[model samples]
Target: MAAGLLLLVCAGAVLYSAQAQDPYDGLPDDYKKGVDLAMEKLTLDPGVRHHFRFLKTLDKSDIESGFGVKYIYHHFYLKPTRCAKGSTVSNAQTCPFRNDRPLIDCAVCYKTAADQIESFPKPYVHCIQKPRLTEDTRTTRTEHCKKMNYNSGAPTLLAVSMPKN
Candidate 1:
């Protein structure tokens, strides 16, 4: 009877361990390390702390055969540390929309698994707007923000791309 109970306990433990495994465990070691470093920066920034929301995945291995390149892009939004006087915003942890700000795009990329070098390339992060808006720009932004759990008000600001001389 005791042996049966022990077997049951062990089974339960095994199941729990399987469920607790990280979903990204299959990712390359460098990619995982880079993501950790990026997250650390977001949490450690002194002014205007930012948070990332995963946007989409880009698998380029089919096109770029040798390097086994893949990318996951995340966009950063300002974390609300302060509120306007008499503002309805109540959550300090949640980011509120401010018209003056622009969302920053950050790309985490992974190259061939064989490469073991640390800091071969850092995650590419930028606040610069795309040179121009295409027909699909609005649709894409809306979808991305929706995934990020922001309200409808957050993704509506259409950026007007200025012409280069």
Candidate 2:
């Protein structure tokens, strides 16, 4: 009877340990769904969005990728829009839009992932808008954001991308 009880205890302990060990357990399902939705939206603009995949367990990989993409998008697409009205707006900076400000900033939209992906760093996706310059006038540019990386991690682990549009 003692031996059977010991075996049962050992099995319970092993089960507990297995349940406690979470490789991608840090990421929540809701957050993962949000990321999926955002990625789907971005994929619609595949010509202008780049997706970079990375390992899920690493920290800051997704954030870094998101920031990098935000940097490129702001510089090429959003900045130009701000400058169109002869505003002396600085590039590669935070949002200039206030509650009363009429300007729409991409940083406001793209920065969401930076904070959300603090735990899992897998499937880090970023979009770079490649704008074509026309006649030295910078008008009539074709903006294309391409996926830089895709599914770049081990098959055993789940990689969650950032959810920001």
Best candidate, TM-score: 1
Lowest lDDT sum, 10 consecutive residues, model 2, at 101-110
Q: Judging by lDDT against the true structure, name the best candidate.
A: 1
Task: Provide the TM-score for each candidate, comma-separated.
Answer: 0.35, 0.22
Instruction: Give one digit per residue, the lDDT tens place, for model 2 in 42-145.
Output: 54663432332111321221223333222111111122221222222243122232232221112111223433422222333332332332343222111221
The positional error of residue 98 in candidate 2, measured at the CA in angstroms, is 49
lDDT of 1: 0.39
Candidate 1 clashing pairs? Answer: none
Error of 2 at 149 (Å): 20
| Residue 37 local lDDT, model 2 | 39
